[model samples]
Target chain A: MTKMTMVEALNLAMRQEMEKDDRVIILGEDVGVDGGVFRVTDSLISTFGEQRVVDTPLAESGIIGTSIGMAVYGLRPVCEIQFSGFSYYIFHQLEAHAARLRHRSQGRFHVPLVVRTPCGGGVRALEHHSESREAYYAHTPGVKMVIPSGPRNARALLVSAIRDPDPVVFFEPKALYRAFREEVPEEEESMPLGQPQLVREGDDVTIISYGAMMVPVLEAADSLKEKDGIVAEIIDLLTISPLDDTLIASSVQKTGRAVVVHEAPRSFGPGAELVARLVEKSFYYLEAPVKRVTGYDIVYPLFAREKAYMPDTGKIVQAVKETLEV
Target chain B: MPRSEIELPYRIEYLSILDENGNLDKELEPDIPDDILVKLHREMLSGRRFDERMLNLQRQGRIGTFPPIKGQEASQLGAVATLKNSDWMVPAFREALAEFWRGKPRENFILFYGGYDEGGAVEEGRNDLPVAIPVGSQMLHAVGIGMGIQYRRKDDVVMTFFGDGATSEGDFHEALNFAGVFQAPVIFICQNNQWAISVPRSRQTHAKTLAQKALAHGLPGIQVDGNDVLAVYAAAREAVERARTGKGPTLIECFTYRMSLHTTADDPKKYRSEDEVKEWEKRDPIPRFQAYLTQKGLLTDEVVEQLEADIAQEIQGAIDRAEKLMAREVDPLDMFNHTFAELPPSLILQRQEAELDLSLRKEEDRHD
Candidate 1:
């Protein structure tokens, strides 16, 4: 095991996958000689040559459209969008071709494609660089949307996304790219695509979150335990789509109260889906209404107002307490 | 101060081996086997017959709306004739004839227009991509497949087909740019049918020739008489050879006309004139090719009769088969299939809910 950040863990996953499978290829703008904008694919060009680590021309639709073609042609292509905001240019290709290719062809062809882009706020970056828009991909049918909170899960889930048969949109939390480090195993390890991991088991209320918000969620759980004498169950929802709901439903059933947290806007966000699922699966078991601490419906604010836009520890703690009140 | 004109590397060329009067430029004619020429003529004829039959079927409500491949048969079948079985054919919606020439069954097209998911199921080992309905989207896939072929050091090239209006799309430029940058062995065939639904080709782009659009991306570009089978075949053959030998990508714009509506649902009378349609009818590919083949002693009146009869029987057989397939009770649950390799738990629950809903509906229907 070695201590690595999320960026290093993701790079290691791509390296290991490429080494094991000759069909695996990495391509995007500046992904080759210049590594990547965020340096997530650093030093990969030297190891895999330009053929496998291709530096494509700067066009989002072209990168993804060509990647879909490569995947359909029996090559495992992992493409990168410079940022999550740039992903809008690729949504047409994603929705029309990548997401629908398998179902459109009735299993005649499938896209073994992985699209990795850094998302979420708190990096104090330029406009369009921040924002968590997992809802767009999660709402798309025949596409898998996965977000990893930390280094360990990021590495394992990225490997799983690479091996998945369908197209997978992997949103790497830009905030967590180097925020912390974890001891990631050097050997091959992969978590299932849709299974949520229970980081903490408690009885008072279930605190469910994913991606970069898990940092504040963890801090709030600790604060709730020490200050309020309330132990909160923590669930990290790695895969937003295909939400196994098994863990969330059972966790909510046990806790009888739940608080969901995310960095995306509150309206029609992943938090809404979690709350709806809880109401459906564990309605009778509920002690109080499920609360959500999420970003506002307005545009993701600039760095000056980033704090007020994101769901921090204080907001999560307050939401959890609100769920526990009744 | 006077500025000197910059000398460009490429000069776009126009090719026309056969004229509207069935006259061929003997020196420019490609040396093709007599049997293959006959096959090409037969396939073009079959494509025309298929279009006529499909139109009648749609009028009778036998199939859903589909784009008609009239007047563009030579552009499609002739270009596709240059492809070997090992090469790939990435197609947009209007390349049904090309797909048929590449070994896709006629019934598949019928099934697709009939709105069945099984229609898009390409058999294993065929390198053909399913017909992409979105305009210009399949071109990038062709470039990607070429990239894969280059990586494997294979000689097989990829040929993709799209319409003239697709040139306006960003994907069109992006696909051409990447193909040129990567030196991917891909032949882009733009069938300039002169119309994108209600919009005319002139409105699609300001460029004088769609073929010249490739020059901006550093690729060879050429224009051809799309109605002339000899011209399209020759250009496709040259492009295929160039790509096969790793000379990089080329763009061939076959200037054709939309003799029919853009689709079954479109009304050409609303936007186009009858005089223009008549002008293009004089240059229709089939009769021109037929007259040329007959003059060369390669075709006879008896052969024409025999070929038409064969095409009729084949299309009738396909229609009957599609009708039989359509008669079967469609499984509602089949919609949930093929979204993923394995159904996730969420999908499993949704499928179960659908199944239970169907069973409960059946019970209610029995009581009613």
Candidate 2:
């Protein structure tokens, strides 16, 4: 096992997949010789050549539209949107064509494509670069949304996404890209999408979250255990769209209380869907109602107030306490 | 000093072989085999019959909606005739005739028009894209496919069909620009059928010709008399040859007219005058080609009659087959299945909810 960052894990997955399948190609703005804006695709251009790892002109719609054609023509394309906010420009191609091609084609054509973009706030980046809009994609049918919390999960989930027979939107939490490192297996291994991983086990209230928010949730769990003698179960719902309700239900059943957390706005966010599912499936097992600790429903604030805008250990611990009290 | 008024440089080439009276210009006649000529005429006539039958089917509410190619048969037949089975074709909405030439099943179009499914069947390796209705969107697909072929080291060329109105779209320019930079093997065939819905050709662009628009993209541009079957065929053949030999993409603009409404639902009378339609009718390609064939002693009156009967029967058989086909029940889970290769947990729950909703509806219906 070799220790790597989330970015390195992603790069390795892409390299391995491209080597395994000639049909697999990558396209995005600044993905070629420049690597990626965050260096996630560093050294890819030299390894695969420019034809396989393409640096397309800065047109989001053009990138996605062309990928559709390539996919239809028997090529597997993995496109990178420089930032999650920029991905909005190609929603017509993503929602209208990429998502519906198979069902509309009556299973005649399958779009084996992956669109990877860095999402979430707390990176102190410019406006439009920091936004968690996984809910928007999850709401739209015909796209699978995957958000990996750590290096090992990122490598496994991305490989699975690349080989999947349908279009996938892989959201890499920007804040976690270099914040943490872990030993990832050198050999190729894949984890099935739509399945949640139990990061830490405990008998007390469960701390359910994903993406960058996983860091704060884990820290909050530690705080609760060390200070208050509360052993919190931390569950990372890696794949957001096809949520692992079975895993969530089982955890909530054991703990008897749940606190969903995320960096996206509180109202109608990804966490809302999680809470709704928990309520419906594990309602009888719950000792208290599911509570969400999330960002406020407003535009991501300036750097001055960035700390307050994002979920933190304090907010998550408070939520856990509130849920436990009720 | 007064502001300088700079002149924009432009070059346009016109290719033709048929005169206005439907007589073959002796100097430019193609020495085609008799069997090939017969096949061309047969396909053109069949396309016309199919267009008419589809229009009737739409009116009878047997099919959904249709984009008819009533007057553009020769333009479509001529351009598509030059394509080998290995070459690729990307079509805009109005290229139903071209779709037929590309071997797209008539039943697929019928099912698409009937709103039963998204017209999906393009025989693998036949290199045909499904009908793109978003105006000029298919141009990009054509360029991308050409790029893919180039990467694979294949000698295949791609022919993309669009319209006069598509020239105004940014995608058209982007596609052309990419093709130029990559020196991709592609032939951009623009069927200038005059009107885009209610908008006229003049409104689409201020340029003297759509073909000349290709100059900015660093490619040769040629215009041909679309109603003259031989002229359209010759121009397309030249362009295809150029692309196949690695000379890069060419833009061939076929000057044609739209003889019918945009589709079965459109009212052309709201936009154009009867006199304009009458003027274009004088140059109708079907009768013109028929006259030329008769003059050459290649097509007897008996042969024409038999050809018409044969095409009519073939169309009727297609209609019967489409009608007899069983409609598949809509699967709600299908909506979730293709979105990702693996089902996400949230989607699985949503699918369960949808199934529960369907069961509830069935239970209510039983009570009613």
What's the count of clashing pairs in each model shown? Answer: 0, 8
Docking quality level of the chain pair in candidate 1: incorrect
**Highest TM-score model number:** 1
The structural similarity of chain B in model 2 to the true chain B, as TM-score, is 0.92
Residue pairs in collision within model 2: A142-B339, A242-B344, A242-B345, A242-B346, A243-B345, A243-B346, B64-B113, B64-B114
DockQ of each: 0.02, 0.02
lDDT by residue (tens digit), candidate 1, A38-78: 77898888999989998665457878999999999999999
Give the candidate number with the greatest lDDT: 1
Candidate lDDT scores, in order, read 0.87, 0.83
True contact recovery of candidate 2 = 0.00
Q: Which regions in candidate 1 have their CA more than 4 angstroms from the true location?
A: A1-326
- Please write out the lDDT profile of model 2 over residues A1-326, one tens digit for every residue: 99999999999999999999999999986676557767788888899998998876545777788999899889999999878987886788999999999999999998889999999877654446678888889888889999999999999999999999988999999898999899999999999999988999999898889998988898898889998999998889899887768888899999999999988876799888888888788889999988877765555643324564566677687778888898
How much does candidate 2 score in TM-score?
A: 0.55
lDDT for each residue of candidate 2 in B1-368, tens digit (9 for 90 to 100): 98998655446988777866776788888766677677778888998888888888878867755778978998888898889898899988788778887788777777667643334557777778877765677899999999999999999899999988778766799999999899999999999999776557875677899999889888889999998889888888888999999999999999999999876756776558999999899888888888888888889899999999999998888777667652444453343444467766765665564455455545646976
